[model samples]
Target chain A: MPDTGLLLYGGAFGLILIGIAGIVLSAHLVRIIFAVALLEAGANLLLLLATWHQGAAAPIIVAGRVPDLMADPVPQALVLTAIVIGVGILALALSLALRVQRAYGTLDMHEVRRHMEQDIADEAGIDMPSSSHAPAAVQTARQESGA
Target chain B: MQRLSSALFLLGLGLLIAAIFRGMEFGTVAPIVGQAINSAAAEQVGAANFVTAVVLGYRGFDTLLELTILFTAATAGGMVLGKRSPTAKRDPDAGFILQAGADLLFPLLVIVGLYIILHGHLTPGGGFQGGVILASAFFVPILARPGTRMSHTAVSTIEGLAGASFIFIGLLAMFGGEAFLTPLMGQGELGALLSAGSLPVLYLAVGLKVGSELAGLLAQLSESEAVD
Candidate 1:
């Protein structure tokens, strides 16, 4: 039989890689958030996996019989807290995504970025009323590109 | 091109992780610290559940910080998503059968959640899990009748009191005991309902705090207007 440790490690890494791929390749903000959740789940899995031992009983103490092999309590505690924290973070991210979608009228990252850029240019143009408010470095780069 | 690059990136990352994990064996080796904890857990804490002891007894400080993080997220989510525009459409109430079922099950869930929280010292379930369960109990009714509004002030008050009680218990322990969060009162017989002094109380506070916070988050998310 394959070692459970190696299998768990592989699964965790696979989840993380898949999530990263989803984040990088997907344009939708919701998909990105889902990917982030997947990343967290992978991390949590890895943490729990670190504590697993063959023939181990759960950390619970039985009445008369002494526990022979007990899994690590510290990592279990850490992972338990981490799982809740991850959910809270995921909720916050979803809220931010909701607000962003409302303001920009789009969930696509590219579309949102374009809208943001246009808004920034409009605001800067209004504020300056003369030369564009583009940063000196960016202006120089744009000029070089045009030339 | 994007797909190819992403695949390449993932492949490299996977290789790196595999290399890092290659030498490790699964479940074959017992942790040094775990051995000590298991031995001491039964004797010192008198809590049947070792994880609960660690969470609410040994490393209680971390649990406090966890509560703070959860509270902050709930507050932030509410702040960002609370305001409803005039043009937003309300979701209709659920069907009669679903609503009836939700109504019947809500109290039962709350009772179960409380039982879990109260028995945390003796069992596998703890404050965080019970609190989430409690929050889900509240969520059922909200789902049943979308138009039914929960009192924001009441929910916040429940959250505030629960959180304050948690801190108050910890501070009380600090004053009475040698260090902060040192369990006050003496440990009773193991596996008894009244055993594991202060652990159950702290778990109760955590359960309430988490329950209210998550319920508020759900309400905020459900009632808020979506992007057009």
Candidate 2:
């Protein structure tokens, strides 16, 4: 059998790889977002596992048990920071997807792109807005395109 | 062909996991953890909870950044979802038992969340875990009763207060001439419910802040103006 610490790392890394595969293969935007989130969490867990060894207890200060704090606290701090960032990223992605759904009337990624290309063709004069705030532009363009 | 590719993917994943375990040196690092925690970590940081020591003392700047990350997420999400979403159309049908049970369970969950946050230094759980619990508690009502109304304004108010209190606590620590998150050393009985200085208080504020913010975000997402 493999060493326990490396085993955990392996497990985490495998989960991450699976998550990435899901992101690539899944067509649904929400599923992709979830896949990305899973991958990120797995990465954080793997980083944490690298700092920890077997038989190491949680680094808490207990009376009469002034055991050496063997585990790396660096990973804990990093994971906490990552968790917050992950939450932010997920929320933003969901909100954007929601906006996309509202504007294009369907979440099929290709369909939305096609709609935009049509808009660009019709409007020929003005360059398209950046993707982040495309809805505002699409709303205006749709009024003119009327197709 | 698709099945073959999927089979290959799974096999590759298995091999990768096997490799990580095979390569790691697990036991050699044990002594290092002991040394870091027992003498060097404890004395250098004058706090009882070692995790707190790590979080508030050693990597306090990281904690500050984490808080800002949450703030940024809320702001970005709000901007995308809009500050105010239309109220959702009421479902108008709620089971009596679910409504009654949720009404009772809500306060209980809030209380438990508060208790966990306050006693974090003494107990197993801490602010983040407790915060999620509190959010779930609030979520019960929305699950059972579609007609139930949650005021975004009220949620925002609660969130603001909780956030301010967290900052205020940090300021208190700075004013006392310690580092940004230095636990305000108190003579309270160690291992008691209310010992360990400002750690418990900080945890409480964090729990409340996270819980309210998450709840507000959820309420905002599902909220659409109740269509006539």
**Tens digit per residue, CA lDDT, model 2, B132-202:** 78887888898787656677788778778877877777788889886676767662664666666666777
- Candidate that would win on TM-score: 1
Give the TM-score (0 to 1) of chain B in model 1: 0.95
Q: Give the range where candidate 2 chain B is weakest over 10 consecutive residues by summed lDDT.
A: B26-35
Alpha carbon deviation, residue B71, candidate 1 (Å): 1.1
TM-score of chain A of 2: 0.75
Q: How high is each candidate's TM-score? A: 0.91, 0.79
Lowest summed lDDT across 10 adjacent residues in model 2 chain A is found at A64-73
The docking category that best describes candidate 1 is medium
lDDT of 1 by residue, A1-147 (tens): 866667777799888888888888898999999999998889888888887887788888767467788889889999999999988998999999888877887888867875776688797775322237855655564456336
Off by over 4 Å in 1: A126-147, B1-3, B226-228
Model 2 misplacement above 4 A: A62-64, A68-70, A119-147, B1-48, B83-88, B187-189, B225-228
Worst 10 residues of 1 chain B by lDDT: B21-30
* Candidate with the greatest lDDT versus the true structure: 1
